[model samples]
Target: MGQFIQKTSFSEKDFLAFQDKLHQCLEALELVLERPGFGLGEPSIGAELELYLLDGEGRPVLENQAVQDTYDDPTLTLELNRYNLELNFTPLPGTGAPFTALQQQILDNLAGLNQKMDPWQGQVLPIGILPTLQERDFGPQVMTDLPRYRVLAEAVQQRRQSTGIRIEGQDSMNLVHDDVTLEGACTSFQIHYRPRGQDMVNLWNATQLVTPLMVGVSANSPLLLGHRLWHETRVPLFCQSIDGLNSQSEHPVPPPRVSFGQGWLRHSLIELFRETVQLYPPLIPILSDEDPLAVVAQGGVPKLEELRLHDGTIWSWNRPIYDPCNDPHLRIEMRVLPAGPSAADMAANAALFIGLAQGLSEDVEPLLSALPFSYARTNFYRAAQHGMGASIYWPNAHQNSLEERSLAAVLEQLLPVAEKGLIQVGVNKEEAQTWLSLISDRLQSGQTGASWQLQQYNRLVGNGHGNHEACLQLLKAYCHHSNANVPVAQWPDL
Candidate 1:
């Protein structure tokens, strides 16, 4: 999605050409994957943090372009909304102290961006959904003035006619929009893991299995449009926001553009790319110059631009990535986690997620057999809706049956698994212990980002602040603690 194109429109011919290219890319990917030395390197991890730019009143501010103009950092880029910006960190090796390095990178980059925002009296926040955002904040006008974003908006609106969002939690919200800008309200801290080609299947399956547990512990973005929605409102908000499938159509509808997935991946990672190309129609079908088949024949890596762009359009919680930059490789992009609370908190979330995925992959077959994929899907939504308070079904080896267990209790049992996974992946013992302890502490305290936000909001509201005012005050306190880089578990109550 970061690859930029100037073209704003695509014709029928363009779509046909792009579709052909996608198939060719898949063929080339199959051959590439079979090569002896392909993607054979030490494991590495990277992340992209999406954030909100806010004004003195704790509302969204449109200054991403201005920040880009004054700030000379290439890692920082504009998001779908002008009020949002994303920071891409350099990939670090899994060994030594990658999580600690990630934490520092976040602090350094965010500090530099905040310094530039000082001139505009603007502040940067790394939350899933900014609670103060109003209905007027979204629409055609709020979209970033980029060709990709504009074309994406037009493409989704064309397919769905209109996007309707109906979320029922502590408060209910039912609204509709003609454009996909509502997706801009949700931000995330996406983690990228480049594993050896042999471990791809196990790692990918493990990621899916542990996602619910990760979401439960790392829950954030509880409030949206001041409605106090799901503990992690970004999950449903993002899915319903840019959904392209129209139920009114008489033809059979495809899976949603944003989804957990239809079912568990059976054979290889190639199955994912094939399913993506076959099931989902091309949204932005801009043809690339490279012939992937020709590149593969010449024993060279193909950029697979069309397949990548198409894959980017499909918002899977765990998406497969094929990158030809530097050395050609495949990576699993974990898109389930939200941004913020603090840099340490974000790093801790990543550590637990990556560690658990690695640890569980060793025995993933039995785990998957014990817990059905449908139950895994159910657990994901339940975790998002209830956060730490949610009870999930887990494989109880002792009874040889699936047992309903508290999310916190499940996390407690999984902490050691995560730690061992981290060590297996080459993360130093001290680094693994330091980061995993944060998760343990958070679970013990029952104070995830969502819980803290809810508690603070309720307290302020009880003290006579109006809903909107409480949101602003909560955001103010949030920014203060987040800027201090304090863990969410340790943040003081308002």
Candidate 2:
């Protein structure tokens, strides 16, 4: 979705030509994958942190372009909404103290952004969904003035005709939208891991398996439109916001544009790309001049521009990325985690995810057999809905069956697995411990970003504050603690 296309509307001819190019890109990808040493670089990790910009009163502010102009940082980029900005962090080698390095980069970049926003009386916030967001905040007017975002909104609205969001948790709420701007309300801290080609299948499957645990422990964005929704409201909100098919349509609806996935990757990562091409119609079919097949034959890297643009539209929770820049590589974009609490919490979340995926991949086959793919999918939503309080089905290796377990208890058992996985990936022993210990403390305290927000909001409401005032107070304290870089587990209630 980051790739920019000037045209807002596509003709039938454009769609057909783009489809042909997509197939060509797939052929080129096969050749590239078969080539020795391709995508076999040293493992590394990167991240994109999406944030919300707010005014002094803790309301969403439309000052992203101004901040971008003043900051003059290449890493800072605008998101779907004017109030949102994303920071792209540099990739670091997945060894030694990578998490520590990542933590520092997050802190530094956020500090710079906040400082730049000071002149505008704007503040930067990193949260899954800003609790203070109102229904009026998500209209066509709030979308960023970019061709890519406009075209995307038009495309989604064209397909679905109308967007409806109905989420049920502690409370139930139903809303409608004319465009996809509602998705902009759900910010995330997306982590990227580049693994060796041979390990892609195992690593990808392991990532899917462990996602529920990660989402549960790091759950945030519990409130949306002043309603107490899922622990991670972003999960459901994002999917429903841009869903292409209407329930009233008589045509057979395909899988959602945003989804967990139809099933596991049976053979290789190629399966995922193939599924993307086959299952979803092209949303943005902008053509490129270069012939991918010709580029592969001439021993050159093919950009696969159309394929990448189309892939970006399919918002899989764990998406596969094939980058043709420099040395071509494959990356698993871990999109399940929410954006904030603090930089420390985000780093720990990344460490836990990368470590568990790598560690579980060693014996992923057995684990997958013990816990069916369907179970894994169910567990993901369960965790998102209930956070640490959710009960998920896990593989009981000794019993050779799946059993329902509390998310917190499951996380406790997985800590050692995560640490081992990090060590196996060449991370320093103490570095691994330093980050995983945060997860440990978070579990013990039973206070994730979601729980903390809910607690504070309810506490304020109990003291006779109105819903809006309570949300504002929650955001104030949240920003204060987040800017202080204090972990959510250690945050004090208002």
Q: Each candidate's root-mean-square deviation in Å?
A: 1.8, 1.8
Error of 2 at 468 (Å): 0.5
Please give the CA lDDT of all the candidate structures: 0.88, 0.88
Candidate 2 least-lDDT 10 residues: 244-253
With candidate 2 superimposed using the best TM-score fit, by how many Å does residue 270's alpha carbon deviate from the native? 0.2
lDDT of 1 at 127: 95
Poorly placed runs, candidate 2 (over 4 Å): 196-198, 244-252, 398-400
How much is 380 displaced in model 2, in angstroms? 0.8
lDDT by residue (tens digit), candidate 2, 1-494: 56558878889999999988888988889888888888887789999999998889888889789899998988889999999999999999998999999999999988888888786687788999999989889887898999999888878877874557888977798876656888899899999998644578899999999999999999989999899999999888887787733532334376678888777778888989998998899988888898899999999988989889999888999999998888689899999899998999999999999999998887888777788787898999899999999999998656545688898998899899999999988899999999999999999999999999999988999999999999999999999999999999999989
> What is the lDDT, from 0 to 100, of the residue 300 in candidate 2?
92
